[model samples]
Target: MSTPVGGDETQAPQSRFAGITAALRYPDIRTLFISTFANQFGQGTSHVIIGWLVLDMTGSALLVGAAFAVRSAPNLIVGLAAGPITDRYDRRILMKIAVIGLMLTALTLSGLVYFDVITISILLCGVFFLGAFQAMYMTARQAYVYDIVGANRAISGLALIGLAQRISQLIGALLAGTTILHIGGSGPFLAMAIGYLIGLTCIFMLVEVGDSAPDRQETIVENLINYFKALRSNRLLLSLMISTAGAEILGFSHAVILPILALQVLDVGPEGLGLLTASRFVGATVGIAGLAIAGDVKRPGALLLTTMFFFGISQIVLGYAQTFWVAVTLVAIVNIMATMSDVLHQSLLQLSVSNEQRGRAMGSWIIGIGTAPIGQSEVGLLAGATDSKTALLINGASLAILALIMAALLPKLRKL
Candidate 1:
């Protein structure tokens, strides 16, 4: 007997290869992806090298923290303007200029090391410039992805981009340690500069496929006012902004206490601390990969909320983890949840706004992430007063509680 007409689905299932393949079909996207990978790889390498270099120079934890802070501090100042600037200009040009700026900064820093003239003040100046360029690149890149693929394929496209960055980060981190061991501090800096150059080349080949937002005649202050005004009108976007900021401050911020917990509480020592740190990055890779495999989720907002809730739960358990292995597993779980949330959150945010407003929306989102330094300080103070474990436990519980409240209040976000 003949099978039913539509039921003759004997071909291989499509879900088996549900990762980056769809997005990779576009030549421009492939070029863009490569560029993003190179930049992220460079960032990963530079991160480790900068921290090590700072420690070697000053031999003080405070200075090391300050050095890293210099790299991140620009996000707060630049984030608000990033979206508006991205919306009003050609993303390709923005990225090119930004990448070029990054390359120059990296090379200058590398030259300092080469000439043995690297000073803390000079290093801070270089990092500040690096961070400023990164802010623009990030805002423009996200808007550009939507422009290229449109909303239909955006989730997979962005997921693919994230996967590339995550993998590159792992490679860069691994190479950083070994490169430093053999060739001294200059090795990683030069390597990172090369990566930036590679990224610049990729951007050079990337053809702009999306419409550029018409230039607004408004002044900077007026544009800033418009951005906030737009944000206020969309309750869903506003809710997402608040919820995301909350996650960063309450859940993500707890990471600041990890070093302390590893040393004082778990007694894991430096080796175990490395493992513990590495586990989270590894987990981030797995988490993003899982999202890529799933491709499009029917209910991204719900998935986002679930991740946030579970992340908080993971943190609570992590707070109580007594053994090194237990802490590692818990930290991985937390990262898995956090990464999933970020992927979903970003995809959903992109889908929620218009192309003209996309950059501004992203800028608002970046503010949430930019709150990291604030959260770090907050968690540090809390930990200082009442043990790291207690601080983590409180933050975790607070995240879960706050997420639930937001979900209940923001029906629009729940339905997304």
Candidate 2:
């Protein structure tokens, strides 16, 4: 059931925490928030663990990217279908299925590595399934948060979700890194599997869907066909998707080369790489917390464009950092904008469409971010052929230029 909205909300006692307090008042949102923490914790650790594993087993940057590429490839393939699917079914059921998939995959990967039977082929297959489930779960979760919170509280709901994700990801990254250093085994993957179990338990507590249920009765193909038809006239959404895809393909792909940067460039090994990963969440925490406190933004498009521009520039600067601390600081700053871009994209996309269409809008977001595999492959191969520094310079510049071009050419987007 949807939370009843009251006109009195405008007259409520206010504080910096007002937005957060109101959203958490719902039991469903609270449990879902906890699950978010668990889910992202697994995700944070998986990125570092899987990337490092592929690197260790193959000793090739291109292979590492290829592994990550296989992992994210599902977004492009399954994301479109996932949108209408989530809207058509009970999202709670979909969430459970995705979490279960995560649990089994993580457990299998852990056991394979523990028994010393793991190979590059097995690892690749493992990450591919992990990525597919993650794509479905993320798209559903994005729409479900709105289902629980209603439109009035969407900004805060999404901001709070971002907070949970960033903090847990920070802990996950640090723990995964430390686990590698001390246990030096499958402990990280085991921990990841357990995290999904915890998340699944939380899903059991969810109640009912909001009043704004499915918008129309249509088959999956008919629903998608209409959405695509809508996109022809929805310039703002098209622009949003293009910009989101650009950021994923360029700015966020910096992660694909972190292993190379840690070992060859910074010489800090796994521990330092963990710090680099943790710093991203720290930066994201700042951005998300600020958004939660700031509450609803009247004009988010301008801010979104600004964040994308800086996000791109920071990546370019990161390529030139020599010291470990300097690189860490740069990574943190890069993600501050990165997460802001993320929050803006999800919030704006959900708000842009009707209640019933929100899932498909988010599905478009999934499709846009699916470009990550392309970026990952490019960075990994370029680093192997030339250097991590050069790859960063190129991708970073392209992203920054794209942001500027969007701001200039798509004036409607900026005004949205």
Worst 10 residues of 2 by lDDT: 4-13
Supply the TM-score for candidate 2: 0.96
Overall lDDT per candidate, in order of appearance: 0.73, 0.85
> 136-161 in candidate 1: lDDT tens per residue?
78878877876766666677777788
Question: What TM-scores do the predictions have?
Answer: 0.85, 0.96
Worst 10 residues of 1 by lDDT: 1-10
For model 2, the local distance difference test gives 0.85
Using lDDT as the measure, the top candidate is 2
